[model samples]
Each structure stands twice: as C-alpha cells, then as structure tokens.
Target chain A: MADEEKEQQKQGEMEELPVILQLRPVPAITPVEEQFLKKFRFLKAWESSMPTELFLTTYAQSVRVLLCHGGTPVTADTIRCLPSLQCVIATSAGLNHIDLTECRKRDIAIANAGDCYSENGADYAIGLLLDVLRQFSASDRYVRQGLWPVKGAYPLGSKLGGKQVGIVGLGHIGSEVAKRLVAFGCSISYNSRKKKPSVAFPFYSDVRDLAANSDALILCCGLTKETYHIINRDVLLALGEKGVIINIGRGAIIDEKELIQCLMQGEIGGAGLDVFENEPDVPKELLAMDNVVLSPHKAVLTPEAIVSLQDLLMANLEAFFSNKPLVSEVKDE
Target chain B: MADEEKEQQKQGEMEELPVILQLRPVPAITPVEEQFLKKFRFLKAWESSMPTELFLTTYAQSVRVLLCHGGTPVTADTIRCLPSLQCVIATSAGLNHIDLTECRKRDIAIANAGDCYSENGADYAIGLLLDVLRQFSASDRYVRQGLWPVKGAYPLGSKLGGKQVGIVGLGHIGSEVAKRLVAFGCSISYNSRKKKPSVAFPFYSDVRDLAANSDALILCCGLTKETYHIINRDVLLALGEKGVIINIGRGAIIDEKELIQCLMQGEIGGAGLDVFENEPDVPKELLAMDNVVLSPHKAVLTPEAIVSLQDLLMANLEAFFSNKPLVSEVKDE
Candidate 1:
C-alpha cells in the first residue's frame, strides 16, 4: 500500500512541471544559453530526430508556452498547431518577426526582451553616426594602408557638436539614442505614431518634415505595415546633401533601392547601417563608399545584453507558469 | 615738400602694421589660412627661395610675434634666431610643438588655441573609445569585406554601460569625454596632477592605481616631461587584458613600442590612437590587428574647429597689439 501511494505521487509531480516549446535552439544567438537551458528546460523541436511536424503534433498537445526570437518566425500556422499554447516568449526587443496579427487575433499573450537591448542599440546607433561623420573606419583604413605621409593631411570630418539630429520611432532605442546625442551638444527631434505628452523633444508627425529639419536621421523604429519603406526618396531629398542617415532599425523601413540611388547621385551625405533589407547581401556600390559604414546586423549584440535577454526570458516564463502576468507583455493595438 | 610728408606718413603706417613670422606656410594646415593671410599678413619663410635661416635672420630680426602649429616645431634654436620675438601664437591647441622652457626662459608670452578645439577633441576622444570598445570599425571592415554571410555571425562586442573609464587628464577634452560617457551609463574616474574639488568622480593621483581599477584609459593630458611615457609596460600590465587605451593628446604620452608589444602579447586588449610617437609612422604590427584603430593625428582638425581657431588667433593678436592681456595665454609652469 505504501509503494502504490509513492508511485502515484511521483506521477503527479511529473505532470506539474511546465513545458516550454522551442522551434529552434536558443544557443544560436548566445553561447551562454546552453547551460541556462538545463536550469529552465525547453522542449526543442529541432532536437528530435522525428519530423518537426510529427514532433509538434505529438508533444505540443498540452504545451501552453512557446519560446521564439526575432530570427524564428512564429507564424499563424505554427500557432494554430499548438491548441493549448496561450503565451509566446521572444528573446529579442524587436517583434517584427513574431506575426503580431496572428498573436493578437488568437488572444495569445506575448512578451519580448523589453529594454534589455535598448542601451546596446542606442550605443551602436550613435557609434555608427560618429563613424560616418568622423570618417573613422575610412581613416583607419588610410592609416593602416600607410597613406598618412603620402596623403599629407587627412580630410577634415564634419563636427558632431551642435548638429540637428532626427530620431525615428522614439521608442526604447530611439529615446536612449537621444540621451547620448544631447551630451554631444546635438539637438534632437523625433517622429512616432503619435506625439508623446511626457516627451519634451519636438515632434514631427511626418517623417519627411523630420528629415527636413535634421542634419542627420537615425532610424530606431520597428518594422510594421506603415513603417515599411517609411524612409523613401522624398525623405532622403528632405535630408539633403550633408545629411547623414544611420539605420539601426529593420532595413525595409527604408527603401533600399532608393537609398542606394540617392547615395550614388550624392543627394544624401552618408549612411551608417546595421540592418539591411536582405541581410548578408549588402549593396556592392556601398562597399567602396567611404561615407557609408556597414555593419553585419550587430547593433543589439553584446555580452551583457545577452545576459539581460536571458534574465528577461526567464522572468516572463516564470510569471506565466505561476498564473501571473508577463513582465513585458505586448498588448494588442 | 607735400609728397615727402605723405611718404613719411605712409612709412609710419606700414611700420605700425604688425609683422607675424611663420616658419612654414599656415595654408598647409587649413586652406582658410590663405585668405586670412592677406587680412592679417604673415611673413612666410618657405615662400622665399632663400635658406630658412637666411630668411629668418633678415626678415624676422624685427618680428615681435611668431605663428606656428604642432607640425612646425618652434625649437629652442628657432626661438633663439628671433631676438625680437615677444609672443608665440599657436593655431594648435597643444603647445608641445613650441619649446615651452625656451619660451618661459626668454619671457615670451605664449597663446595656444584655448578651448576652440575642445569640443572637437572631446568628440574624437569619445568616438575613439566607442569605436574601440564597440568594434565599430572592425565590424565595418567585416561587412565591407563581404564576410557577413560567410562568417555566419559576427563576434559580440563589449558593452559600454556601467564600464569603468579612467581619464588620464581632466582637461577640457577629458571633461567632455566624461560627460558623453555618463549618458551611456558609464562610471568615470580620473588621474590628474591634482584633483579638482568641483568634480564628483573619484580621482587617483597615481595613474597605476587608476589603471588597476579602470576598464579603459583615455590620454587627454598635455605632453609634459613628467607625463611622457606615462602609459608604459608596467601601466599596461595593470590595465590587464581587456583594458583599452585612447590617445588624443600627444603620442609620447604612451610608449607606442610597449603598447604594440602588450597588444601583441594579449597583455592588453586594444588601442585607438590618433597621435603616434612618430608622425605618419604607426607600428606595423598594429596595422594588422583587428582591435587596434589608427588615425593620422587629425583629431583636432574639423571644419568648424578651424574657424574657431582662426577667431582665437585673431583675437589674441589684436589684444597683444593693444597692450591688453593676451587672450588664452598659456601661463608659465
């Protein structure tokens, strides 16, 4: 009778453990994630030798939480497959890849990395701006190529102080970018969906108007239906020659083809870009341009930022299982 | 009799006009110098086909002011050549190019570019720091080299937030660097000759102590006898493996030879150097290292800064001729 009672209790304890579903492994983004996976167990769909469809159908019947990130698209099809899935946890600040419409329609709770990537994103955006205005990498190449004496005097770069900088989105990343730029004596104005009452910076309802007033334009908004190709030829023309554009937001937010054309025609001064429309495939024309600084979509990647992302993911998962609200939940618009 | 009197008055007016002796053409530094030369005439020694010594001996004998910059050194011999030289007007901020001891011994009033270049110098210093820590230039190289897709994922950079930065000199440039870093959420400390009562940041009189506690060291101090080679092998050792060094001051402040050796041995992480121990001659080893960023000692050269320098130089000359206190005069140490 004692043995039978012990067996029944063991089975009940196994049922109590919450299962988290992952389409792919988390270690793809950060190396520190593997050890943390042991602490917070995730049922990785990719790990199974069985077909992903078969595994999802068999194992995710009672799964309530799905863990994903900006790289992995959690589509309507995937969400519909998991009948019991009520929550989605993303490990990135940007939610463009998460199929927001599907999440909203199903009433599934969503949590993102929140402000974990804000500081790093802001640091990088400003870094790119400085690199472009200062011609840092171009000059570094000149020095490394032993052209100093031959060149006589390096070209004087445009000054950063007292420049009018326009920030797009003015969300976590944009706001943080503003903080750093103010210290450099830059005046900031921003554009967003709606004017924020708490913000003191001048607001421009139209992106083109912001470009007209700015010496530089820094993109920090998310990719959305309205925001896609938000920065087109009209905006570039408004920014004008000697107007620098730094993009840390998604690439499609700008019209890539038009931006290249503007740069080729010398309509815009320069650009500092982290994200591209089709990443890993940068325009060949920009590769030789000294004014343009290109980075491989690494603005939000940092060692400390990864740690913060992990903490945020753990916090969201714990809260959901405990029958509490997510820490940084994205509400339906 | 009337023509003779008119000639006498014209001679008196020509004598009243101040003569400025230049060892070389100021136009070599800035193109604006050529236009300003006609307004405030400078006797260019290089313009004469005659030997510089012969030109100085003949024309500079009665010249009361000398115009020089960092590139054209006003050595003890050069100062000795001009017996009537009462003032030295430097277009550059740092007066290390001019022999300070010789000037002081001869009782010659010296006026440097004052705070004209401070904003730009600070902008460059912080820009170098951000570039070094955030790997802005290195990543740009990767993207430009078409290695993004081939590399899969670029390496992560260190975060700027909460980093402990040590300023070697708390002059105008260092103060600006601190202000910018604070906005990025970094803690700052400094090592100067004496701690200012007004500054809230922790100060270390001994630079070695500062190196032990800091993640980065920025050299913004003037190149003095005591400050020369301030950052040596011992100091680099204390800064440890991950420490970064940015020099916007004179190149001699850090032992470039030892810095290269440390960087090679992985004893220190990286360096962002604008001024090298020798001009136009950076260590060959640093040219290949990804962590090292080299510039051609043009940190203080900016479009707006050149304008400011001309204004400062003009004001100092006017004040000196009027028997008023020389503006931005460097006090004798």
Candidate 2:
C-alpha cells in the first residue's frame, strides 16, 4: 500500500506489455487494432523520420513481434535487422510477402490470417465468376446505358449449373468455393501442389490437365516460385475457348501477357480477375472487354473479415509473447 | 413391295403427324424448334396475310396443340377458336401469358417448362444478388472507367455469410436459392402463398413480415392475380434501409413505381432486378445508381435451358397425343 510499492507495480505492468513493430501502416485500421494499441505499446516505423534501417536498429533490441500485411514485403534483410524478432504475424491468408526460409532458419514462428478471409474471398471469387459467366456486369451495363429497349434482348448468359469447375489450390478458400458451387449444381474438381488426401473431388497435379477438363478454372493458391506463371499459354489452350478463368489469388500466378493474348484472341471465353500483375494498373485492353470482370484486387476485403483479422493478429501476438502456441502457425514447406 | 404401294405408305405416315399451331414466331428459335418442324406439321399463322382471327379459324379446326413462348399470350378467344386443342405447352416457367381459367374451363391440359429453367433462374438470381450486395457490377464499372488508381480502394462490401435471406416462394427456384445461400452460411427463411409442408425454412404468409426479419429477399414466385404488386412500398419499408431485394420472378410482382421511389429515397438499400413492370423499359432513374444491378429480364436465358425447354415441350406434346399423363402438367388451382 506504500507509495514506493505502488510506483514499482505500475512500472512492472508497463514493462510487461510487449513491443510490437510494424514497418508500414495497415491499409485500414479497425477498432480491434486500436484495442491492441491500448493493450500493448507499438513501435510504428513509418511514423519516424529516421530511415527504416535506423528505425529498425533503434528498436531491434526490444522488438520481439512483427506485424505485416499482404502488400508489404517482410524480406530476409528486414528480418536480419531485427535481431530480437521471435515471431511474424501476417494479416493475409498468403504469406508470400514474408521470407519463410529466413523465418525457418532463425526458428521464428509464423502465423497467418488462416480461415478468416476464406468465406469472403470465396464469395467474391464466385461473385466474379458469376459476373463473367452470367454476364451480370455486362448485361447491367447494357441495361444502364439505355440499350434494353433499343437492343431488344441482351445476349444470353451461360448457366452455372452442371459446369465443371476446376479449383486451383484446394485450401480453405478453394474448399469454400467448391461448397458454394456444389449448391448451384456445379461439378467440382481441383489442381493443387499435392493431392489432398481428405478431398473427395478428382485432383490433378498439373494445372493444364485440370483446365482441359474444366469449363471454368478458379485460382486460389499462394504466390510462390512454383505457382508463378502456372496458368501460362498451355493452360489457357487446354482450357479452350469455352473456358473461363477466375483469378482471386495473387496475379503473377497467371502469366498476365499470355492471358491477355488468349483473351484477346478468344482462345479463352472470359475472365474475372480480382488481382493483376501490377496493383492499380490493369491492362487497358481489359477495360473494353465485355466478357471480362475486373476488380481492384479486393477479393479478401470486407469489414467482417477485417475485424476477424484484427482479432487473429492480436491472438497470435499474445500467444507469442506468453510463449504459448501460435493460433494459426504456417509451417515451412 | 411395289413402288406405288411404298409411296402410299410414306404419304400415310406424313399425314399421321399431328398439326401444331403457332400464334407468333418463337424468337431465337433453337434447333429444338427446327426438330419440332421436322417431326410435325406447323401451321405458321404469320405466313398468311390473313388476320390472326381468320388464321385461327382456318387452321384451328385441325390444330390439336398450342405452342407458345413467354411473350405470346394465349387468350380465351384463341383457345375457343381451337376446338380441337387438347393442350397448351409454354416454353417458359411462368404461365401468366396463358389463360389458365379458360384452359381449365375447356378441359385443355397445361404443361409449363417445369424445372428446366429453375436452376438457371436461381443461379442468375444469386448472381444479381451478389452483384448488388458486393457491388460487383459497380466495381467492375469503376475498374473499367479507370477510377481505381485515382480513388484508392472501393468501399468494403457486406459479406454474404451469416446474413438472413428470405425467399419469396419456396418453389423450385426459391428452394434452389435457399440451397445455394445455405452453402454460403446464410440463414434462410421464406414467404410463399401457403407454407410448404416439406420445406424446413421458416415461412411467413405475409411478405412484409419476411422482409422485416431478413437482410435480403429473393423473389422467385410466378406472377398471379393475388401475387401482383406483392412487394409494395410497405414491404420495401419493412425491409428497411439495409435490406436488398433480388427479383428473378416476373415484373409487377413488386410495384415498380413504389420500388423506384423507395430506391430513390433510400428507404431500401439496394435491388437486383431482372424483370420490370414494363420490361425492356427500365425506369431511367435506376440507370445511374450503383447500388442496383439491372439485368435485361434475363434470369432464365441459357442455351442449356433452351435445349431443355425444347425437350420438355416435345415430351408434353408427345404425351398429350398419346393420351398419357403430362410430364410437366400445371393444374388450375
């Protein structure tokens, strides 16, 4: 109850709060992020005028946890600068931005926004796919431009029922897509790095083989060396002219130039792209195509998803600081 | 067999083929219609310069079946003119164009498209719903117009999961919608003429009640005298400012003028309308709205559906001629 004892208790409590570091600002900070700020102190590298190297060096000794997002790269050089970093938690389903090899080498635990974005991402993928297949967006444009009365009937859209949908990457998002598609009477199959032992749908290790049998192909895998340019000209040709491509995964997974050429030549029927080779710089050719549906790389967005992400990031950080198991740890392959 | 006897036999077979009367040309005639022509004799009314009445009078005596599409109305007078008519087979799911009362009075059997268009209709309804709720069409327009770079990120869309969806007819299309929405983790309920005995979803006799409880309402019922203007201003108001209405059913099912007013005033959040009170002529006010997705009354147009429609029509015609139970018979209530 003494004044000296109370001061010491306050100091100890303050010292116990972990120092979390962020290289960049989160695209959209939520209430959950605000709550994290109140619970634990943060070292915002972006806020400081010092160079990133100087900022990291100054805070390296105390910083044990690193927070990252999809767009921000957490490279080996950045990891090397943070000598005390024990864990890296990402607010995205894919951890391509994080240097996984370095994390594994240093024994630094990695966690991602596991299933938090799956439902929304899958829903968006299906939305994009439907927009392309059903010509919902194109027909909407037709109606909006005062063309309905003048044009009589808009062009007929293809039915979703009985479509052979080939899912690339039978992970959480892909599984959700399959589940939704099944309800619409779409037949599901998949192509993944490895065949999922638990899945009942037919699996093809090669993307080209999957595309050959499918009326539509939905991309839902992470971006890595193995997956980059996976959907090249061969896959497009295998898909044929009636095939639609729905890419919700990272853009580079598909060869952008080849896709554009294929789409232009009608080698592929249509496309629904949520991401492109470059963010915010969509190919001008796609802007004029009625069969294409373009989104601003926002398949994994929704207020609900963002809130869950905040909770998940906080959970991983809390677990790491207390020496407990990370909630959604990503093992190195 | 002598050549003269063989020729006579072929002539007899040709004469035995039933005569089918067409009040109007079926637009976008498929190979199925061509097949019908090859198998049976068609009394094409438009081929003659005679008025429709005179054409019916001349041809009606021999016509045993009436072939019609969605736009062609089969009035009581038309049915009365055809004394030999035994059945009316419609190429659309809705029977609003056919005089059900007159058919019942004349003892003429009715066979609709049945479940041929249900899957496609439901699929399109879901597509429109997704487009409106997630702003897929609007976002596509944004991307196409090249505003993404200038206007940062598009606003976050509401997730389809965990939302309450009320279907306005627990029939084939409505049930399909419920099934699809269920897989998206949406809670489903419904409003129909009478509570379906077999359906597990909660039912409301009044549409306003359903709207009051649901975040979105998908209209999938046929337009009838009792159901016309069912989704009135009261229902829209009940749906609240955040509620979305998706109509794959006939126009006039929702009061068009009231709906326009509701949308303009923000009394309702959004709409995904495939049909209109005066279709081919959507309200000019809705043209610029991003929240509403306007389809060209095309919730049930697909090549697969058209092919199925042909098969159903032929089956019904064959069943009628053979005195067997109709495959897709619609009885008068």
Model 2's CAPRI class? high
Instruction: Residues A100-165, candidate 1: write the lDDT tens digits.
Output: 888888889999778999999999999899899988999998988889978777888989999999
Residue A28, model 2, lDDT: 44
Summed backbone clashes in each candidate are 0, 0
- lDDT per residue (tens digit) for residues A1-333 in model 2: 999999999778867788888899775454556678667877789999999999999888998898887789999999999999999888888888888989989999889889999999999999998899899989999999899999789888798889999999988899999999999888999998798889999999889999999999999999988999999999999999999999999999999999999999999999999999988999998999999999988888888888888778877878887889999998843
Off-target runs (Cα >4 Å) in candidate 1 are A1-15, A28-40, B1-16, B28-39
TM-score against truth, every candidate: 0.95, 0.95
Which residue pairs of candidate 2 clash?
none
What value does the lDDT take at residue B150 in candidate 2?
Answer: 94
- Give lDDT tens digits, candidate 1, residues B1-333: 699999999777656667888888675345665555444557888889999888888976678999887678899988888999999988877888888999999999998888988888888988888899888889888988889989877888889899999999898788988899899999999999899899999999999999999999999999988899999999999999999999999999999899999999999998999998888888788889999888888887888988887778778888987898889898943
Off by over 4 Å in 2: A1-16, B1-16, B28-30
